[model samples]
Target: MKTLYLVRHAKSSWKFDVIDHERPLNERGLEDGPKMAAHIAAIMPKPDLLMSSDALRAKTTAVFFAKAFTIPDTEIKLNHKMYDFEGRDLVEVIKSVGDEVDTLMVFGHNNAMTNFVNSYGDLRVDNVATAAFTAITFEIHSWQDLIPGKTIYHKAPKEL
Candidate 1:
């Protein structure tokens, strides 16, 4: 079985004058991001591969999970495509994952995260809050052949 954990970037600060891609996490995100990452790590197995969008907010959120999993910086991949708000780019990235990876953690934006979970996971999630962690287990052998899978786990900041 392959397990995919999807995490939406922690809440970002609109207070910045920078572009959307450069927006940093707000105070709440800093506090909740690590907590949620550590909480999830305590329950589930560590990811074989950890990836994140190049966007500052997403990358920062991924760092929390990487630390919790004890994943080295060299092993973490930063992808530009994941910066997509739409789910298509994210889908392509996931489908392209090598078979060697049985577990994967992805940090990205929403509408994409929410849409992916709703479409690919059995559970119907109305929204994926900032720093929310959602896991889906697939019975398929390859990431290329994705089907609707069961939502094995889900946790948000407020739920913590």
Candidate 2:
């Protein structure tokens, strides 16, 4: 079975005068990002790929997991598509990942993340809070087969 880890970016700081894309993670987010990454390391198999939104908060969150998982920085891809609030776009991105990768992690924002999990993930969860993670296992051989109720585990940061 293939596994997909959907993680929401850590809490962000509004104090930044920069653009939304440039906003950084708050103190809580800094602490929680690595904590959740360590939590992920303690349980799931190391991720083969880490896809993230171009936003700084998302990239920072992904970085923690990349380091904890020992996945090379080259394996992480930052995409602007994820910055948009379309869950389908995220799904398409996953589907397009080469079939060679079996386990993938995506660090992104909510509304899209929550919507994707609720639609494609088997678990019936509400919001995937900041630094939260949900693991979905699928029977399909490729990412294209993802569907609701296909997920087997939904783990949030709080749960960790």
Candidate 3:
């Protein structure tokens, strides 16, 4: 079985005069990131691979989970493709995951994250909020065959 963790990046700060990719997390996001990360850590198994978008907000959100999982910073893989707003790139990235890794965690933006989860998982979610986490377990042995799977959990900061 293959487990996939889909995490939406924390709320971003518009306070800074920066590009969308460079905007950092807001105050509420900072608080929520760790909270949500710890919440997920309690239930999900340690992932074989941790990946995140290279964008500032996404990367910051990923750091919270990395800390909670005791995963080293160097071990976290930052991928430019994960910066996708459309689910296509996200799907491509997921499908490309090495077969050796049974579990994977991915931090990215929405509606990409939300679309991916809803499209591939059994559960239908209205939205994947900031610092939101959704886990899906696939019965297939290969990442390439990403059929619809069970939605194990979907947790957000507000829900916690």
Candidate 4:
């Protein structure tokens, strides 16, 4: 079985003069990112791979989880494809994952995250809030054969 963990990037600050991709996390985002990461670390297994959008907000949010998971900087991969908001690129990224990876974690934006999770998981979530985490297990052996299995867990920062 393969386990997939989907994390929505933390709330970003629009107050910055930077472009959307370069915008950093807001105050609430900084607080919630670590909080949610710590909460998930207590329950979930360490991921075999960690992937995140190259965008600043997503990368910053991922850093918290990386610390919590004790994942080295070299182990975390930043992908421009994951920056997609439609979730199609996200799906492509998932399908490309090697079988050697048993558990995979990805941090990105939403409604893509929400759409992706609801598409393959048994659970139906209206939205994936910032710093939200969702885990789903697939019965298939290959990432290319992804099919709905079980919605193992879902956690939002506010719920922590």
Query: Model 3 over residues 1-160: C-alpha lDDT tens digits?
Result: 9999999999999999999999999999999999999988888899999999999999999999999999997888999999999899999999999999999999999989889988999989998899999999999899999899999998889998
Q: Total backbone clashes of model 2?
A: 2
Report the C-alpha lDDT of model 2 over 1-160, residue by residue, as the tens digit.
Answer: 6888988999999997999999999999999899989888888898888999999999999999998888876678999888857687898888888778898899888888989988877677778789988888877787777655476666666676
Would you estimate the TM-scores of all the predictions?
0.98, 0.93, 0.98, 0.98
Pairs with backbone N, CA or C atoms under 3 Å apart (clashes), candidate 3: none
TM-score computed on alpha carbons, candidate 4? 0.98
Q: After superposing candidate 2 on the true structure, give the runs of residues whose Cα lies further than 4 Å from its correct spot.
A: none
Off by over 4 Å in 3: none
lDDT of 4 by residue, 1-160 (tens): 9999999999999997998899999999999999999999889999999999999999998899999989875678999999989899999999999999999999999978989988889999999999999999999889988877799999899997
lDDT of 1: 0.94
For every candidate in turn, the CA RMSD to the true structure comes to 0.7, 1.4, 0.7, 0.7
Task: Order the candidate numbers by lDDT, best to worst.
Answer: 1, 3, 4, 2
Best by lDDT: 1
Model 4 segments more than 4 A misplaced: none
lDDT (C-alpha, whole model) for all candidates: 0.94, 0.85, 0.93, 0.93
lDDT for model 3, please: 0.93
